[model samples]
Target chain A: MSDNTGTKVKGQSCRLPRKRFYRARAHSNPLSDSHFPIPICPAEFDYSHHYPYFFPSGGEDHKNGSASPRKVRFADIGCGFGGLLVSLSRLFPDTLMLGMELRDKVTEYVKERILALRASNPGQYENISVVRTNSMKYLPNYFGKAQLSKMFFLFPDPHFKEKNHRRRVISLQLLDEYAYALELGGIIYTMTDVEELGDWMRSCLEDHPLFEAVSEEELEADPVVKLLTSATEEGQKVARNGGQTFRAIFRRIKFEEE
Target chain B: MEETAEFVSNAGEDSASVAAVTMDVDNGLIEDDKSKDAEVAPALIAVHPFEKSVAVAVGFELRLFDLEGNCSVSLVDDSGGPSHSDAIRAIKFGANGRLFASAGDDKLVKIWATNPWHCIRTVSAEKRVSAVAISHNGHYVAFADKFGLVWLIGLEGDNAKQSNNDKKAVMILGHYCSIITRLEFSPDDRFIASADRDFKIRVTVFPKQSLKGAHEIQSFCLGHTDFVSCLAFAYPSGCANGYLLSGSGDSTVRLWDFISGVLLATCEVGAKVGSLEPNGTEDAQSPISDLCASSDGSIIAVALQYSNRVALLSCDFSNGNLSVAKVVTLEENYFPTSLGSSSLSKCLWMVMGASNLPMPGSAQLPTRLRIISGLRKDPSDYHCHDPIILEDNEVPGGQKLLSELQGSLDVTKEEAALAAAAAAVKASMRNMMIKKEYTLERREMRKKNRNDRKIK
Candidate 1:
């Protein structure tokens, strides 16, 4: 398998090489055609193109017994280098998780990484994938209302200067789109080495009506929270430097009226 | 180190001084590599009534610091500390600073005694809260949530009501289908103005006689192209009537005369500020993040999203005209996320947030709170200081760490470690199951093919 890197592979999915992954700025969202050649609509987006394997999107039954109206319940926003996704892929073998990233190169790298993993382990890594999209703008386009169950903002890029705070994925306005996409009781997990960014996420989510801050006790009980601090490359980098990872988990909650 | 200082007023000039964060990349003034380690920025801030102490709310913790002593106020056994489970969105001190009210995503509104900082009453709402506002007298605490429903609960009555039965919160359908960002009661308390994400501001009469009348629309401040995030009232003419100023996602700030329901003036901060931006043509939308106007309404400060500068507008409500006083640029894309004004000589507090825009060598920079003092007829000085970083663990002194959060919560590091190990084991087992099932299926398919060939 190691010698087959340059050779043509046949698995329905195209064999993406490790070197093909390059960094390109996120084609700013709503793809106004000026930045991107074509504007994107959620309806026109074909999931089959990204996932070479057949996924039963409530339309057909699968060869394997796992075939209920299954959708990508887990989403990783700004998934830098796809470290967390690859880690979680084996954990939940059946759960479909999509990593939405801004940088084209990072997204390509994640897709290729997923392909390589799938090649090595047959029937595994099929549920994980990546897409290049700026969550700040096109989150609603990718995710439908109340469609997502879990969203991970792991080691997010903290806009250091105050001016770029809006560019930070977790603003009050963007939180609205997040809440819209997340189902009630859906948990949003955020881990950051930067305490300020952690505080910003906590404050924004706590201020919004859709999310409830899951206490550390509650966060610890869950298996997903465990992956936040150590699963990602950024998290690993922070650990190497002896820095603190402020892990905040918020659950999407609403009253009976909502 | 003062760069170019611009003043709409003395206080405005002083506010610019705190941190002195102005655009200096083009001027080659900033060293480009000074701030490392991201700092905790202020989400909401309240200056105590005594004027000696100010309460700055960052994330979920609310820390009260004595300005004179330059130290945080240590509460009784962390009783006066942050109690809400989520972020503290709204924190406001009552007139004279005796009482402070707060509400957040915890769906609870807590009013605390400012002296020792005791949590006197906690009012629970049905939904996660967005904005909280206390009346002029500080009796009724009104809060809004994601649904744009405003609920008011009385602080004093809450004590007795909790003893018997929880008093039903008075709900008002303030803004339609929009998340109400800012809710404020007028100085006279005649009307309460609410702004929402749908780009509309509604001035409704306060529920004086009946709760039903609380939603009575007095006038609508129309003409904002984007969602209004912050609202403030200013008495520019020094008259009883005031003008409402709103900052919005459209990167514009508009002043509206609530009584007449007229659009007074629009100050487009993004256009001028974009010129100073390095990559303005990269096609990112800039929104107006936060704003605050002085009591006199003489100076209005607007923080535009993605721009390193805060635009200060000097407006006169008398003639419905606004002029851009100066666009004070911050140092190297450092944006102010929150701003507060104290009446004592009209000082302005600016909370700085750094852009995480993948620069060459950008590390997590620390949060800085800059206070511009002497806005009135006094000496101007901008003081930029580090904010109080609230630790997650240090709640109290006595109890066992795990026991304090015993009932529904258990947050010990050991427990988390155990849970993590278990999870890793479970994940590996699941992966093995998938592999086993795949191999078995292939074997079964081969057996079927062999049998069919024999029948043939």
Candidate 2:
């Protein structure tokens, strides 16, 4: 678990963090009010702090319209250990991506991981960042309506009890909020090793009126679909254990007017 | 707090079984050994648009009293469907008094015709219903579930025929994972406002075709420190747009310019009503349970969970300011659970009763109905005299109204029991609305023991 991807930066060694030291529990309750400061709305979010390289003049000057502000179009929900974000950052170099994790220590680890990578490979990994937030309650706070182009729900916590069904991240009710945040034709990518949770997620997506399953031909042509099982820590663990994974990719669609 | 600390400490030694047992107790999954028959349901009340009738839902029974006829109105359902099998959480009347909607734990939304008191449509929802509202135009009915989704159903012209087939409800919007507590249509019917347990009030534009989905969010009213419990709109004379009023579990009532999403004023009803205990424990904090605005939009009556007094606030629409005007104290040991006010009436109706009595062997609890008359729109005239608590005989339907709505209960003999019921309701409300905090190890254990994992 020690990362050897270190490089010399300003005569100092910027070393990657060890995964063992940043180990956290597998799940965190999304309903609890975690101790973290959340932006009231998307306008109030300080993008300069998360992506300082993108906003060279800082966040306040970007509102002056000297340059059109760039928004984060991709979100990785429950992005465990920031593996998927790191992979996606390289794949989509021009696109901005954000990883939302509930665990504080994991978020800190991802921050260090990104910083270390940026130091090792200069001018790269600048478009990806991580934040500690309960996305279930605050998705609308950070992303405006139709602001996102893609959403990833990789290896989500499967709240299995009948009473805890409402807590699942990929529920019909929650899809409405996701649908509101995502632009038309925006894709929602979900993957899980647990078969029941995978079925549940697929069924909820199928049942929602605003979402339509991505065609097999489109999924095969998409580069991100291939990395669903190999880009994240959870997916890597499942791969190592020789466990099969299930995926449900859906596109946000507009309803026909009656 | 101490219990959470103890559980965290114990989790280090033996995590799995201990955490599971603790969660079961915390969630009330383990049945109580003491009183199996004790049920604690909150009594809800709704008033008709023209002050023609008042409907009260307690447990599984729906009771209505016709003010003009001075008689009980029996519901006519040719389908012969059973009444509400569980506690009804919300009851509301349409703007023109043509339709009445009621839904609750049973997940059935029943739309009734007001004139004939017949159940025209019964729609079964996927989850327990929390709040419901009929559009001002009386063409649409919307209900919100505990899972934070709002569903809409369009009504056809005057169909009193009973149909047992479940009508499809269109899903319009949602509040993420939070429970939606209140749904209200703006006075002009241009927007619909939904309040959730996450302290958010979203105002979405009512689209021309709502069945397609409400996509445009006009604004978000977000200042509450706790869950929002109720919402109302007050439109002053000569004003085209109405101001929005919201009450929250944070013990405050706030007035907002919803069109622009600006918080105008906040009145600390908790401080005005005073705490039940002087020590100021968490239990002493009074959360507003229900609130209603007067016909002229001048007076707002607020009811706190554990307090025996209803605090009235005066609204100044010119400057958008709210201030506590008066406090009407009720009889000892009685706390108001719900409050109702009609557009055509000058009286504020209040009900004090619990649906399920927590006391053993007390299966039948008596509900008490009270009314306060002489509520005026002019601030000067409203302040000139104290609010008059009308006697039972002075009520619109008099003794007949009391008997029809209250079910001929003897309130004097159940004073002690009523006090206990109030305490139980307060505790249950806290448990239901407050978010529970858990340690990392306990969360892991709970996930490990998930049934989905076991099934695999």
Q: Please report the candidate that would top TM-score against the real structure.
A: 2
Model 2 CAPRI quality: incorrect
Per-residue lDDT of B312 in model 2:
89
* Best candidate according to DockQ: 2
lDDT of 1 by residue, A139-232 (tens): 5446655778999988776766685464567766456557767888998888888889989988988766667888778866888777776788
lDDT for residue A71 in candidate 2, whole number 0-100: 89
- Model 1 residue runs over 4 Å out of place are A1-258, B1-42, B76-82, B156-165, B210-213, B237-240, B275-285, B353-366, B377-456
Q: Mind giving the per-residue lDDT tens digits that candidate 2 earns over A215-248?
A: 9999989999988888888888999999999999
Model 2 Cα lDDT, one tens digit per residue, B1-456: 333344344422222222221232232222341232323567888899789999988777899988878789998865344568888889999988999999998998888988978987888898888899999888889999876789998885432222436557888888765678999998778899999878789988888777667855667787787889999988888877788999999999998988877788988889877756323353436899999986457778999887778888988877877888898887765687899988865888988777677665545556788998877645567456678889887888888888777767456666766676677666666666666555677566755544445544
Supply DockQ values for each candidate: 0.01, 0.21
Q: What is the TM-score of each candidate against the true structure?
A: 0.46, 0.78
How many steric overlaps are in each model, in order? 33, 2
